[model samples]
Target chain A: MRSNTRKYRLMILLCIAVTFFVFILSISIGRYSIPFWTVLQTLTLQESVDTTIRSVIFEIRLPRIIAAMLVGAALSVSGAAFQGLFKNPLVSSYHLGVSSGAGFGAALAILLAAGTFAIQLYAFTFGALAVAASFGLSRLVKGSSTLTLVLAGMVVSSFFSALISILEYVSNPLETLPLIVFWLMGSFNAIRIPDLINITPIILVGIAGVMLIRWRINILSMGEDEAQALGIDLKRIIGILVFCCTLSTAASVCIAGVIGWVGLVIPHIGRMFVGPDFKKLIPMSAIIGANYLLLMDDIARTLTTGEIPIGILTSLVGTPFFAVLLWRNKVGWS
Target chain B: MTFETRGLSFGYAKDRTIFENIGFSVGKGEIFCILGPNGTGKTSLLRCLSGISMPLTGSVTIDGKDLHSLSRAEVAKRLGFMPQLHSSIFPYTALEVAVMGRSPHLGIAASPSERDYDLAWKNLELLGISSLAEKPYTRISGGERQMVLLSMLLTQQPDIMLLDEPTSHLDFGNQVRLLELLRRFSKKGFSVVFTTHFPSHAFQLSCTVALMNKGTFESVGPAETQLTEENLRRIYGVDLCVEYVSKANSRTCVPIIKNDDGRGVGAR
Candidate 1:
């Protein structure tokens, strides 16, 4: 038992190291490439680095890199929590329709020619609203089982998705349509320091909340009657988890557009590394998710002169990897 | 501790009441066995006793405190419930699953400490299944899973243990072993309440038995008195004979099967 604890601790340390390595590597490889040493030097506040390199590091690459890490960790941890809370491996961070609602919000802001901040605010508010609607709809049922909540989420997701379709249908095809389409496809090309400043606390709080209550998730996954018998305040714990997940997920979508697959795939990978105990799985998912999105973002900017939207890359990369995991029959939950 | 319920009733809807106006109490160092046919609200009664589901029209009390007023943690500290069937989504190790019983004793944010794990391991060792500590609970046999769950209840250290059809899925030997464990625990001052389909189980323990037919218990008394051939026949609609077995030195109930023509099969 002691050795097993040691092994898990060592594995988590290794994952954190890998995440740091990826973070540094991502900062170094952009359009005007900076050397690894210069990137480190600039990060350490050394005066010997060139001003252009420092500006590029701090102004462009650093904010986007931080944004990538936050969004990735937020979505993945929320996904892991939701998967455990719902007791279904197929559930992702968007199980409550946050992404669809945020997509519609961003599309509406674009239709109104709103600025980036207004778009983000609208997206966050509507994303939270969508989950609230789902929860309220589920409460209208008799028992309000987990299945009912999931079905309600599906209903709300499709409703917002239809609203998005309507907005796309009526907009100017040449101007607003393309803008909305690109935003919906997802990108970090426009992430700036102020955007990071705006959403960082909410994201961090969400992640910290999940981290604090991760062990309870294992109890919660043991089914409703069992958990209640074990003395868990089912309503309170589930409410806290949903609130935290929604905060992080809504903040993630507001910033990064509808980035998919990271939440669904990264937790499975984490499980393969450390197994399904959420105490290990949650932090492991966060580290791996940050590394994954940073690498994907790096690929997005440097793959061609014209940047690829990261949502496209994530789906393109995540689908095959998920399929391989499934084909190998190692999706973790037995 | 004394676990008591008064005028308890439950149903999913207004018109479909499963059970009504039921009342019982089990004290320390006693075993209370509830015997009923299938779909007779046995599981529902256990759920109400464990505070997993509230009784529709009455109160369950633990040592004179109304169950509805106490917190869930407080109820769990006094009552440990082993469900009839557990299907875990994740493949947690047996030790991990057993350690979850410590949740009632720990704070909401706290995971099990080394001391808690030691208690769980001690219970597993007590049950003679310590080897299953690292094995995935989903991979173990049903009997072993029951032992693991029993070990979890032991680790919970509750005064009253409520189990719903605990022996329903077990083989013969496992069933005997589990009943033996419950008997031993009762002797050690734990109150045990379990529902089962087998009347022979009640005879084996020589415990207080409640024969439930439709919604309420038809009879509640000593197993020897309540589990008569006539009551068994009326409840189950099958002729059964309750007699003493000189070989096993205990009483047993044997159902008398008849042929299509109404004569007993293999009759002399």
Candidate 2:
């Protein structure tokens, strides 16, 4: 047991180191590339690098890097918490209709030619609204079983998705339609330092709240009756957890425009390495998720002159890897 | 703890009451058994005592304090509930499941500490399932899972235990083993209340027995006095013979199964 603890600690430390390296690498390797030393010199307040290179590092690359990391960590942590709360490994952060709702919100904002702030606000509101609808509909059913919630989520998701399609269909193909398509595809290109500043507290507080109750997630996963018998106030804890998880997820979607696969796949990777104890898994997922998305964004931006949408990149990589993970983790989830 | 119920009634819906106006009490170091057939309110009554469900009509009190008035943690610290056989979705290790028994004692932000881990290990050892600590709970057999749950309850260190059909899924050997463990717990000054379909289990354990039918307990008293053949017949809706075993110094119940022609199966 002691050795197992040592190994997991070492693994977590190693993951943090790798995430830091990837963060630096992502900032250095973008288009209109700055040299690694120049990036570092600018970051460290050295005057050797040119003003243009310094501006690229500070103004553009820094915000994108930070956005990528935050979105990754936020989505993955939310996914981990949701999976534990629902007691199903198959659950994703998107299973509750947040992505589809946010997608529609972004499309509507684009059609109305709203600024970034309004777009984000609209996305966050509608994302939360979608989940509320799902939960409310589930309660109206007889038992409010897990299956009912999942089905309600599907209903709300498709409803919002259809709204997005209608918005895209009516808008002129030359202007708003293309903009909506690209935003729905997802990117971190539009992120500025102010965007990062605005999202940081929500993500941090959400993550902290989840980590504090990480142990209880284990009990909650044991089914409602058993958890209640163990003295957990089921209604209060679950309500708080859902709020925290959705807060982060909505904040991420508002900024990044509905990135997929990170929330669904990163937590599974964390579980594969750390086991299902949420105390360990939540942190592991956070660090690994940050690194995973940063790496994916690096490839998305650097692979070609025209930037690839991160959602496309994530699904391209995530689906196959998750299939492999499911195959290997036969006993764990199945 | 002195656990008692007064005129308690409960049901999922307003119009349907599973049990009604039932009352009983068990002092420290006593064993209380509720025996009834399927669809009776034995499980519901146990749930009420554990504070998992509120009694609609009356009240349950532990040590003269109303059970509903206590916080969930306080109730959990005093009363340990072992639910019927359930399968967990995640692959939590046996030790982890055992350690969860300490949750009631933890603050909202606190995880189990080293001392808590030691207590869990000690309880697992006491239950003779220490070797299964590292095994996944989902991977264990039904009987071993029950023992693991028992170990978890032991780690809880509650003054009273409420078990709902604990031995329903166990084999005969395991059933006997669990009964022996309950007797040991009684000797250690823990009050036990369990629901069971077996009249023989009520007979084997030296405790107060309650025979329940419909919505109320038909009789409640020492097993020797309460578990009459006539009561068993009415409760079970089958004619049964309650006989004394001289060598074992115990009583057993055997159902008189009727053959196709209405003759007793044993007689044929």
Candidate 3:
């Protein structure tokens, strides 16, 4: 037992180290092509760096990198929590329709020629509203069983998706249509320091809240009756988890558009590393997720002169990886 | 703990009361067995007693304190409930599942400590299933799962244990072992309340037995007196004989089966 704890601790430390390395590498290899040593020197506040290099590192590359990491960590952790809470491995962070609602909100803002701030605000608000609608719908239909909530989420997701389709169809195809389409495809190219500042606290708080209550998630995965018998305040714990997951997932979508697959795939990878004990799985998912998204973002910007939207990249990368995981039969829900 | 229920009734809807105005009490170190036919609300009754479901009327109390007023943790600390069937999605180790019994004792944010793990291990060891500690709970057999759940409840260290049809899925030997363990725990001064379909189990324990039918207990008394041939016939709608087995020095229930020749086999 002691050795097992040690092994998990060592594995987590290794993941954190890899995340750190990925973070620095992502900052160094952007469009401006700063060297590794100069990136290191600028990060350390050295006197030898040029002003343009420092500003490029701080103002552009650093913010985008941080946003990618935060979004990745938030989505992945939320996904893991949702999977455990719902007791279904297929569930992702967006299972509650946050992404669809946020997509519609972003599309609406872009169609109106709103600034990034209004788009983000609209996205976050609607994302929360969508989940609230799902919850309310589930409550009205029956008691809050996981199956009912999942169905309600699907209903809301399709509803918002239809609304998005309507908005896309009515907008100017040449101007507003393309802008809305690009934003929905997702990217970190538009992320700035202010955007990072806006979302960092919410994401961090969400992550921290999940980490604190992660052990309870293991109890929840045991199923509702048993968990309640074990003395968990089921309503309170589930409420807290949904709120935290919604906060982080909505904040992630607000910045990164509808980046998919990180939440679904990363937690499975984390489980392969550590078993399904959420105490270990949650932190492991956060670190691996942060690294995975950062690497994806790096590929997005550098793969071509014309940047690929991260949503496209994540799907392209994540689908095959997920398939490989499935083919190997190592998703580990059994 | 002296656990009691007063006029407890439960139903899914206004017109459908599964059980109504039933009451009973269990003292320390006593074994109480609830025997009833299928669809007799045995599981629902256990749920109400465990506070998983609110009773439609009346109240359950532990040592004169109403159970509804206590927090879930406080209720859990005083009472442990083992469910009939557990379906696990993730492949958590048996030890991990066992350690979850410590949740009510821990703070909201706390995971089980090493001490808690030790207690869980001790319970598993006590149950003679320590070898299953590392096995994935989902991969283990049904009997082992029940034993693991029992170990988990033992780790909970509650004064009273409520189990819903605990022996229903066990093999014959596993059933005997489980009953023996319950008897041992009762000897050790823990009150045990379990629902089962087996009247023989009641005779084996020689404990308090309640035969429930329709929406109320048909009879609640010592196993020897309440588990008579006529009462068993009435509750089960089957012809059964209750007789002493000289070889085992215990009474057993045997259902009468008719041969193809219309001869009554072991009827009289």
Candidate 4:
């Protein structure tokens, strides 16, 4: 047990270091390709560095990097928490209809030619609305079982998905249609420093909430009766857990459009590295998720002259990598 | 602690009551067993006693405090319950499951500390399953999982324990081992109430045994008196032979073998 604890701690430290390394690496590898030393110098020297390099590092790359890290960490932590709460390893924020709702909201905003802030606001609102609809629908059923909630979420997701499609169909084909579609595909290309600053606290607060009640989250996964027997107030703790997961997932979707696969797979990877104890799993997932998305975003910027949509790249990379993780026996549902 | 229920009535729907007007009391250092047929509301009665559900027509009190009025954590601190064992979706280790027993003692945001871990480990030792600590609970045998659950209950340090069908899934040896453990807990001044489908188990534990039927306990008394062949037959609707074994110096209950058409061979 002592040795296992040490190994997990060491792995977590290594993951954090790697996240830092990847953050710096991602910032240096844009179209202009600043060297590592110059990137460091530009960050530290403030006003004294060369103007163009400083702008590229500070104005463009820095905000994007922060956005990628925050969105990744937020989605991954929410996914891990949701998986534990639902007691289903396959559960992710996407399945809760939040992402689909945000997608439609973003599509509608794009069709209306709303500004960036309005787009984010609409996305967050609709994402929240979608979960509310799902919850409400579940309650209307005779018995609001977890299975009922999941089914209701699917109904909401399909509804929002249809709404997004209708928005695309009605828009002017030349101008708004492609823009809406691209945004639906997801990217951090439009991320500004102010956007990053605005969403950071929400994501951090959400993450902290999950971390604070993480042990109870584990108990909740033990099933309703067992958790109740252990004196966990089922309604209160479950409410807090659902709120945190939805908050983080909505915030992530609002900022990054609708990046996929990170929330679903990163937690599984974390479970593989350490065991399923949420105390270690949540933090490990955050570190790994930050590194994974930072690297993917780096590829998004550097792969071709045009920026690859982050959503596409994640599925493209995530599928094969998930396969490899399974091949390597890292699927630690246990 | 004294556990008492007065005229308790409960059911899922208004018209269909599972059990009604039930009354019983148990004091410290007493082992009480409830025995009945499979669908006889045995588990439901235990659920009410454990405060998982409220009784409709009556009240359960723990040391004169209304059980329903106490906070969930407070109830858990005084009364630990073990439901029928189940496999969790996530494969948590036995140690992880055992440590969760400390939840009642913890704050909302608190995880188990080193002291809590020590307590959990101590209970696992008491159950004699300390070596299964690191094994994934899903990978362990059902009997081991049962022991692990008992360890978790022990870690709660409750004054009274309400266990539902505790021996349903255990092997023969594990069933005996678990009954011995329950006897030990009763001797240590912990009041225990468990529901069972086994009459022999009631006799083996030497506790207060209650025979439940359609709605309430048909008979409740010392195990030696309450576990008679007639009462067992009345509750189970099957003829039983409850006999004493002089060599083993204990009683065993078994169904009497019947020929075709549910009759004893000698009758034919």
Better of 3 and 4 by TM-score: 3
How is the predicted docking of candidate 4 categorized under the CAPRI scheme? medium
Candidate 1 per-residue C-alpha lDDT over B1-268 given as tens digits, one digit per residue, 9 for 90 to 100: 7889989999988688999888999999999999988889999999998888878898899899998798989889999999888868888888888888998999877777778889999989988899999988878887788888888888889999999889978888878988999999999999999998888999999999999878898879999999998888899998878999988777899888888988678657
| TM-scores, chain B, all models | 0.96, 0.94, 0.96, 0.94
Where does model 1 sit among the CAPRI classes?
Answer: medium
Q: Weakest 10 consecutive residues, lDDT, candidate 4 chain A? A: A1-10
Q: What's the residue-level lDDT of A124 in candidate 1?
A: 96
Q: Chain A TM-score of each model, in the order shown? A: 0.98, 0.95, 0.98, 0.95
- Stretches of candidate 1 exceeding 4 Å from the true structure: B259-268
lDDT of 3: 0.91
TM-score of each model, paired residue for residue: 0.97, 0.94, 0.97, 0.95
When candidate 2 is compared with the true two-chain complex, its DockQ is 0.57
For residues A50-127, write the lDDT of model 4, one tens digit per residue: 898887888899999998998898889988888887788877867779999998888888878999998999998899
Candidate 2 stretches greater than 4 Å from native: A1-4, A32-42, A137-148, A329-331, B255-268
* Candidate 4 second chain TM: 0.94
The count of backbone overlaps in candidate 3 is 0
- Stretches of candidate 4 exceeding 4 Å from the true structure: A1-4, A46-48, A141-143, A324-330, B258-268
Residues A1-334, model 2: lDDT tens digits: 5215678889998988888777767777866766777767788999777888888888888888988998899999999998988888888888889988888888888889999998998888899899888878888997465567778989999999999989999998999998898888889988889998988888888888898999999998988778878888876787778778878888899899878888889988887788778888999999988999889889988899889999999999999998998778642653
- With a 3 Å backbone cut-off (N, CA, C), the pairs that clash in candidate 3 are none
Query: How would you encode candidate 4's per-residue C-alpha lDDT over B141-206 as one tens digit per residue?
Result: 877888899889999999999998888888888788889988988999999999988888887887
**DockQ scores of all models, one per candidate:** 0.69, 0.57, 0.70, 0.61
